[model samples]
Every structure is written in structure tokens, then in C-alpha cells.
Target: MFQPLAELPPPALGEREWLLECHCARPVTDLLKAQGWDVVADLDCNVHCSSPDRRVYVGLLPESQEAARGELWHIHVTDNSGTRTWRQTFGADTPAQAIAGFLAALIAFPARYCTCA
Candidate 1:
């Protein structure tokens, strides 16, 4: 059984380093899966999770893209017609603990009124 999001242990420094370099998506993907999101992984090891109105993507992106420079995490919520209504990104140097905290909060609350959702 999956552990509750609030109870999940934060990833250690070494683990975070490994995840950043290897693009391992299990940690985040598993948490999203437990929250009823559908997850898919590509050959490049990028992970994508989607719910009815939201999508989360985690990957090692090329630094060349202006929006993706130093950012590996991407999240967005879309409208019924598929237009993105909200979006956020986290930089490469962001701590795993911070990411976990954000995700925990996100899971605990509904996204209806919040831009961070």
C-alpha cells in the first residue's frame, strides 16, 4: 500500500542528486499515482501525470529553452477545451524536501481557487 503524502519521507541529498542526474521519475510519479492521477513514462525517462484538469511533468530538460532553463519540473491545469489555465515550474537546484512539501500541500487541497495548483 502507498503511504500517505504527508507521511512520506523527504528524499535525502544523495537521492536528490541521483534523481536530478538520472531523471528517475518514480518518487514523484508514485506519489501522484497514489493521488489518483494517471502516469506515463517516455523512453527518455520523463514522467507525465494527468488528472481530469491537471497535468504534471518531471524530466531533465535541455537548458537552452528559455522557460526550461534550470527548471526540470512542470505543472499545468487545463480547461475543458485544452487551454492551460495555470502553470508553474521549479528550478533544478530546488531541494527535494521543498518539492515534496509543495506536492503534499497540492494533494491536500483542491486547485479550484489557487494558482499554485
Candidate 2:
């Protein structure tokens, strides 16, 4: 007979966990997935959402660089027509905050910035 090991709890808010470390990024990705969008959470912690038409791609970079200035996020919308719009310095107080902001944006105006249009 063997005993079970002690359980471990998740990290605290201030911990430097990756944006997509667990299911933290699921809310946004799940929504997009339900809408027939292809969502990819890359190894670098960035997420990409694309439409079935392959016309538009929405990329969310929570923290591209480790050593930099402020805690910034880069969000961009690109299309095959060469039309692109981006925000290179969307500041966030923390990774959770960044995920919240990005989720809010996607929920509020997905068509405006995403292929959901």
C-alpha cells in the first residue's frame, strides 16, 4: 500500500507565470473556437486566431520580450488584402489583467478587430 503525495496549489497573482500557462487563456480561445475560428496558443505564449476563410488573422502577444520597459501587449489584425491594424503598447499591470483586457476586447468588438466580421 502506497500513500499519495501532497497536493500543490496554483501560483499567486504576482507570480511570473506565462499568460497561457494553464487554462488562463481559455476563456478567449474557447469563445473564438465556438465561433468556428482556429485558435493556436504558441510555445511563446502568444495566441493566434484565424477565420476559416484564411483572410484575417488576429494575434495577441501578452509579453513578447522579457526585459523591456513597461508590461506591454501587442495586438494586431491582419488580412490577405494587406490591411493591418495593431496596438504595440497596450499596457497591463499584470498577466491576469492583460488576459482580462484582451478577453474584453474580443467580447466587445470581435468583428471590429477580428475575422468574426
Candidate 3:
């Protein structure tokens, strides 16, 4: 069953920025946001280990179905706009609980950042 976004624990990383790395992207995004931090953007890739095809992406704004890439990450995991900065790029499907916990910490302590979607 999908973990309801609203039920997502408060940011686990004790910060506001998070990078969702998983096959189940949207749902995870929902869960993180439910914790309090807003999702600025996401990027799904076609493969791992940076390629010319490798590029920073924004999944939060998928223009169409073609936007679904294999690997994804938040454009600015560490938005320095605020007091703190976050940066992370990793593989998805990282055990739900661990991810949830990381996100919770981030939410509890957030820095200044743009209002990304």
C-alpha cells in the first residue's frame, strides 16, 4: 500500500531540502511534502552513473509522459537561499523508513529557498 503523504513523519534529516531517489517517485514526493517541506522540483534519469545523457533534472515539472526518466533527483537538494544548504544525489528505492526519517529531519530545520514546485 502507498504510504499516505499526510502520514509522512516530520522531516527526518532535521533540514528542509530532500532528494527523492526511488522507482516510486511521486508517492515519495507526496510523503515528504506532507511532512512540511515543499517539493521544489524533481528529475528522473534514463540510467545511472552520469552520461552525456546525464544531466540535472526537475521532475516536479514533467511536461509529458516522456518526462519519466529512470533516475531522478531534486534540482536543488541544497538550496542555499536560506540559512542552511542541502545537496544529495543517490539511487532511489532506499528503504522507505530511512528515507522518511531523513526527510523528517530536514523539515524540522529548514533554510531559505525559492518557492519551487
- List the lowest-lDDT window of 10 residues for candidate 3: 47-56
Prediction-by-prediction clash tally: 0, 0, 30
Global local distance difference test of model 3? 0.42
Between candidates 1 and 2, the lDDT winner: 1
Question: lDDT by residue for model 1 over 1-117, one digit each (tens)?
Answer: 899999988888777654333234555666677877778766755556776345444333333363356667777666667777777777666655556556768778774675665
- Candidate 1 shows a clash count of 0
Highest lDDT: which candidate? Answer: 1
- Candidate 3 local lDDT, 3-106, one digit each (tens): 99999877867776754444544554565556443445325322212111222122332333434452233333422233224445333445444544554565
Error of 2 at 83 (Å): 2.6
- Give all TM-scores, in the order shown: 0.58, 0.44, 0.34
Two-way lDDT contest, 2 vs 3, winner: 2
lDDT for residue 29 in candidate 2, whole number 0-100: 64
Error of 1 at 48 (Å): 1.1
* Cα lDDT for residue 63, candidate 3: 38
Candidate order by decreasing TM-score: 1, 2, 3
RMSD of each: 7.1, 10.4, 13.0
